[model samples]
Target chain A: MKLSRALGASVFAAILMTGGCDTVWHPSIPPVAGPAEFPTGQIARGAELAAIGDCSVCHTTEGSRPYASGRGVQTPFGVVYATNITPDPETGIGTWPESAFRRAMREGVDRDGRNLYPVFPYPHFTRATDRDIAALYAFLMTRPAVHADTPPNRLPFPLNQRFVLTGWDHLYLRPGAWQPDPAHDADWNRGAYLVEAVGHCGGCHTPRNVLGAETDGQALAGGEAENWYAPPLQAASPARQGWSVDSLTAYLRTGFDAGHGAAAGPMTAVTAELATVPAADVRAMAVYLTSMMPKPAPAPVVAHAGEDPVFAGACGGCHGPDAPMMRNGAPSLAMSTAVNAPTPRGTIQAILQGLPWREGQAAPYMPPFASVLTDAQIAELAAYLRSAYSDKPAWRDLPAEVARVRGAS
Target chain B: MIRLTVNGQQHEVDAEADTPLLYVLRDDLGLNGAKFGCGLGQCGACTVLVDGQPVFSCLTPVSVLAERQVRTIEGLGGNAVQRAFEDVQAAQCGYCIAGMVMRATALLEHNPHPHEDEIRAYMSGNLCRCGTHMRILEAVRQAAGQGVKP
Candidate 1:
């Protein structure tokens, strides 16, 4: 989702600059003089929505105060620093009224009526109900007010102009809350709202147009994040095993399933956040996401004795036939989503940046090979894995792909 | 039978192609310098040098080390790094000391004089449960100053 989000934002800039539409402006709401009071129940509900939204992952830096917001979100155009949403009177959104927050969520405008960038993902947030927005505002306002100034975004000339967002929003922004789908049951509708609005899964999963807006019909057809490929969740999913609602819930809630490996890269943080929300909500999401996928065909498992020294050495510890991890029921590489992915980017990335070791937590952990293996070595190993484990065709231009990913890292 | 060089001696060991070099070193060859802590490579207790690069021997299979040079703490007997560790008394309970020394040896071999930050990052893989890190860092610094043969 990282790369696609960047490309989407860059496309937004192009649309904004070229559209040459009217520069729409709204009168700024005078700063609320004091802290506004919200009900306890509303604050609690808002907390759930924020977790589902994964607000902290982007808005907070590692080991810093949450929502203090100096984290640099990467985009194709440049870096957009997540703004401080804490209730700090000086640097955060302490002065903003609920109306201002609603407008920002609905119209992609700030309290000052300045056009906020699309990197904030208002395109998805626009579909959220008014009650949810109020709840989010309450939750944000009640936070331990942290005072930290966000750095200026690093966009080139025309893209740097916030005014350009006005035109981009005109072209892409579909305002108003999501209406319940009459055909689908309440559970499905709830899942759809969470996925489209708060979860904003499409912000990363959905492929974007040249102008950076997500392609209308192709909702969860795979996309890119940072450098790793986010595999499709729809009919084109590369999953060798079919996803059931229960399995999807387990994967999203805990970041691992016996059939599929742990979530790596950007999705790791996502699953971590999802773990905090209600399991029922996650199950609902699983229900909706699984409905889109057709029954998976039995994955062809090939048995080629891997000859690559790197795989035998670096990977055999966990993945080899007699390895303890495999012996203890870890899934085979044949079941790996990345190995079956149409692109080699996911596999290459997993090798270079292995699953991290969480302290005191027992999970699937692999040491990073970015330092351990050379780019050429990584390419050779990736190819060896694909041929050995799956019946998929050998990935093309693997050396170039490895080089590109390593260079980006 | 997999043939590989260990501590300047070539040996043929009876093991599977995917058998971890750690088991071969400890179980077959009886060279126990590399411990089998968390056979999952997260702990660097099984660290050894493969072609001068540090790797978790528990994770590295003999199949990959066909003709490669594998050096263990047994090979570094009283070498500069060992001497430095001894001089600083950088061991507590001493379970993880061997792995720490091997990883530090590799780091020095690659970058003889690394910055404090670089040393911390390089040594992150090796876990020292005894918490004798301050002394271990001193030993590495001492070893870097004395300079050892590659």
Candidate 2:
């Protein structure tokens, strides 16, 4: 998800006047010899936590050494390249003491005290327990260090200034380890901690204000990520079937639940990483998330099979009622959360991008149509799908939206 | 009964709605052009033209084919694209050849003179497991050069 935060000049000036300069610089820690060894159990636990955090998804560039960190995340201000987090002495966090690592996670600052852009998602990381952070540090320090300099961020003059982020932290950063609610069971608390802290589902799923802070009380109420909409997990969820713990657990682990459609776009990577972690942890996350969701209200069946030749010719081979995929338990289009989503972007994106073929793995596959079909054809197909499968009103100005998504992709 | 228009002929075939077009073609009508390599549509062995668009007939139910023009390798008979395939000897096991020919025919019909990259991109949906991609690509290129007469 791109960070789209832009501060008004008045707010910037006020923050500067009200002590933006106070903690602008942090004392750099002296480089030290890497730790010789860490407990295997601690490192293993850290590995699991890192998978839940999805650190590699944003940090590592495609086809590069993991955690060397040259992936440039697009933001409204500019592109922010993820910093090298490997234990490389000069280029990475090799010299970072556990305290330094803890501070960075809790305060979103480097050992040298430069304010990190929130694109690193340290806001959510701030709530991680000390034990988890220590484990993560041990795990990271044990990895093969790679020397790679992080590219300079491409932000404009005022935004490029690192101290500006100090003000942002002041406005939004909530620092503390998660505390279990007395009322909830252990599963609920464990799920809550993981979801609210390291899992950080809100990083992409929660809507942000102009300042880029997650909106006050709309946690997980749908947000945008990497051009595709992250569907809400809250009451606003458009899922035709309510996501239960089992369904959510299955979806999180394997990227697909029979009742819901397959995960696509950024979520595909997240689910793949989640597959590596313990199944119980994923199940805990499901428990917490499903608690926030309402039971599936029985939606009145809406059947309008209006003929759209593009859909039939293009989509019918697998998605048609009589198609083998549908007959063999592929989720019906009516049950697809993307098709039932309020916006047409998700459905349009699914059509244009299609599910990529995973090599050797038996996953759902659809050929991309960005080149094959015109924007108008995709837009018409999306409209047909909405009417055919969903009870929601037809999306207005779909052709323009399709053009926008196509161009963005 | 499903009414389907295959090539220039209209035929009423008795089959369930969910029956794949490939099954109806091979089992009932006795047309053996489209082969079933992978019924999941990944291999694209059972490709046919539905209203000028190439689709996997193995995954396409006959129920969705009503009033749509269905063109198989049998329907092509001695078309230029098929002739180009024969001329270039693009078949190894020849199982994937029919589907490859149908996809190439659709591409040639649409573009007629596609560049090599364009041909590769368009034919990506169809797979040839016999390691005969170079020959299949050559066949499409050769057909484009000869200007496929649809």
Interface RMSD of each: 3.2, 6.2
In model 1, the Cα lDDT at residue A301 comes to 61
TM-score (C-alpha, index-matched) for candidate 2:
0.78
Docking class of 1: acceptable
Per-residue CA lDDT of model 2 for A1-409, tens digit only, reads: 2333336453476578666766666777655785558899999999999899999998787656889999999866678999999999899999888888988999988888778989888889999999999899888888889999999999876778887777777778877778899998999899999988998999899998887788879999999888898999888888998988998999999988888879988898899889999999999998888888988566457686865655665577778889888888888899888888888888888878878776556666776656435677678778889999988889999999999998888
DockQ of each: 0.36, 0.09
Top candidate on lDDT is: 1
Estimate the TM-score for candidate 1. 0.84
lDDT of 1 by residue, A112-224 (tens): 98888887889999999999999999999999999899999987766677776776776788887798899998888899899999899998898877656788888889988
Q: Which residue pairs does candidate 2 place in steric collision?
A: none
Residue B42, candidate 1: alpha-carbon lDDT: 82
Model 2, position A28, has a per-residue lDDT of 76
Point out where model 1 deviates above 4 Å: A1-21, A24-26, A296-309, B1-35, B48-54, B61-90, B101-124, B131-150
* Index of the highest-TM-score prediction: 1
Could you give the DockQ of candidate 1? 0.36
